[model samples]
Every structure is written in C-alpha cells, then in structure tokens.
Target: NSLAQFVFGFTESGRFGAARQTKNSLVINMSWGVGLGMVLDDKIFRGHNGFAGEFSHISLFANGRLCACGKQGCLETEASGWALTRMVKEKILEGSSSILVEKMNGKGEIQMEDVIKAANNDDVLAIELIAKIGDNIGRGIALLINIFNPELVILGGSLAQTGEYIRLPIKSAINKYSLSLVNNDTQLKLSQLGKRAGIIGACLLVRKRLLSLS
Candidate 1:
C-alpha cells in the first residue's frame, strides 16, 4: 500500500538518502499502534496477504495481559500508547506518587499525552513508566533485528514525542538483549515525519493506486 510505501520512501529519502547507503533498512511506524514496514531493494515488501508487517501482534508473553486481538501478551499489550495509559492507571490506582493524579482532574481516564506531558515535566513515575514501555518495545525490536538485521528501525507515533526518555531505554534494552554484532549496526530513529506520516502515506497510496489503474 502507498501508506507503507510512503513511509519507506520518506525514511529512505530523509535519513539514508540513497538506498545503497545501507545494506538493508526497515522502517517501523509505531504510534498509538505498531507496525513493521520493510524496504527491500528500494521497494516496499508486503507478504502474500498484505499483512506482513503486523509487528504489534507478535506474541511477547505467554501469560501476559489480554490484547484487543483476544490474545494474551501480544507486543501491543506492553508497548503501545494504550499500554502506557494502562500502566499509568494501574500505578495511580495503587496510590503511586505521580503528578498525573492531579493532572487527571477527576477524570477516570489517562491519555498518552498526559503521560508525555508528565514525563517532560520530570515526573519520576511518568519517566519510569515510559521507560518500561520502551524496554518492552526494544525487546520486540531486538527480535526484528535478529530476524531481519535491517540497518535502521524508525519509530513513529505519539509516544515517539517523548524523545530520549523513551529512546534511551529502548536502546539500552536492545543493547542488552540483541546480539552485539547485529544490534550494533542497527540504528533506532524517531520519525521526522511525525503525525503527518499517516496522511502522507495515505495520499501517496491513493495516488499510486490511481496511477496504476491508469
């Protein structure tokens, strides 16, 4: 699809410049959700059913929290924005110390933006929770590195806005778990495209599809 293709193209053009500059590169667009997109020989690869990049559903824990997909311990359960909110809510319910308590304003819901805001404000609990999410994401990325050995892993989505607070932990986890030889070469990057990625990708896809039909 163009969404996947545009993401791949944007990453290649913005970061790597030339496709040949890297051995192999993978573009992962993870926001409130997660997905893995690949650029192989400068082309987007969608497996047989066009469902190749369902990285979010990868089973990470055998008996972990339930996922919307009706599976337990899926990567999304631990690493996505929803997961972050869940963690924060759990902590708040436990009476953990956090600025989020007041930030909630009596609302019984926690949003990912609230977590990001709290983390940016140097809230220890927020920072720690985000770090945990990053670590879980890193573990998932490590598996991808082992399997694909791509030269790059680009992170996008609302959570990527937290920058180093999240990236650092993910890098640390990757370094600790991933094979040094393979992990060392892979670069983890935040999306420069930001929120525009989905729009850009969707537009690109439509244009391409129409062009193909012509």
Candidate 2:
C-alpha cells in the first residue's frame, strides 16, 4: 500500500501537479503504522527481501514504550495512527479532558478518525497529541532527509488530515533534528490526492506491471 502511494506522488505531482518533473521523492503514509515508499531516480526501492520502507519500526527509544512489532521504543510507538489512538485512550484514562471522552461515552471505542475530527474542531488534548506525534515522526524523517536528501517528502494517511496541526510540529522537528543544508532541499507536503493515494497508486502499479509483461 505504501509503495503504491509513492507511485501516486511520484507520478501525479511530478507529471501533472505543481511538483512536476520530480524524479526523487518519498511517501510516508501515517495510518496504523508509518508506512514509507521511496522513489530515487524514478524507480521504487525494495530492499534485499523486498521489505524496504518499514520506517515505523526504526527503534527510536532504547527504553521507551513497546511497539506492536515487539520492539521497544519504535517510532510507531509515538507517531502512527495507532499511537494517536493509544495516547488518547491513555490520557482519558488518566482523567485528561477532551471531547473524545464524551464521544466515547465512557464505554465505546475511540478511533483515529475521532481524534482527527476532535483536533480539527480545536480540541486541546487532540491537538497536543498530534503535535507530539508529529514531532516524533519528523525526527524519523529527518534521519531520512539527512541520508537520502530527496526532492520531496509526501505525508498521507489518516493522521496527516489534521493539516497544520500535524504538519507544523513535524516541520519544526525536522528543522531541529536535521541539517539545514540537507532539509533545505526537501519539500514536505500533504498528499493532494489525499486518502485515495493508495488505491490510485495500486491501479497504476498493476497497469505498469501488465504493460511491462506485454
């Protein structure tokens, strides 16, 4: 799904959108986990076992919280949609007030979308959570920027919909963590194709594959 998303950014913007003609870019899909897809020199990068772009599991903390991948302190522990939901639930359990408490009604579940909606509606707790997670995610991206120094970094998926609530923190963190000279070359933007990025990229991938076989 993530690799397909990179296809969307690589082709859509580079060919038709404002970032046209770009040949090197990266896509970070912020859903259940932080999914990454890289395009360098106009080609997708699949690592040795085709398991590349697992940006979420890049263990950031030595003694931090445990992640679903059974690792402690992974970036996903703080930055992904699952992380956002987890943080909200933890805060609520600790008596942190937010509209989410009312939305959950003390029994039902609170989802990622609910938090995003709350943030967009100016819920203080939700906004704070997003800012925190965005900062962590940006730290991870900063490492990538310093290394790959791609032309663009496209952020997509559910969490990114919070708009500047998320983007600003990520941008700030990137500035703080990455080298000015390196990050200066990168253009970070939310996916214009929005939620449909993965689906469209999948379609484009299939077409490309079939055409190659022909």
All-Cα superposition RMSD per candidate: 3.0, 2.6
Clashing pairs in 1: 2-205, 31-157
**Against the true structure, candidate 2 has what lDDT?**
0.81
Give per-residue CA lDDT, model 2, range 133-186, as digits (tens): 999999999999998988888887888789999999999999999999999868
Tens digit per residue, CA lDDT, model 1, 1-214: 6545545444444333323356567666656666677766556677886657778899987766888888888999888888888889888888899989986658757788889989999999999999999999999988888888887777776787888998899999989888999888788787777777656666666666789999
TM agreement with the true structure for every prediction: 0.86, 0.90
- For model 2, the superposed segments whose C-alpha errors exceed 4 Å read 1-20
Candidate 2: residue 37 Cα off by (Å): 0.4
TM-score of 2: 0.90
Candidate with top lDDT is: 2
Q: State each model's CA lDDT, in order.
A: 0.77, 0.81
What TM-score, to 2 decimals, does candidate 1 have? 0.86
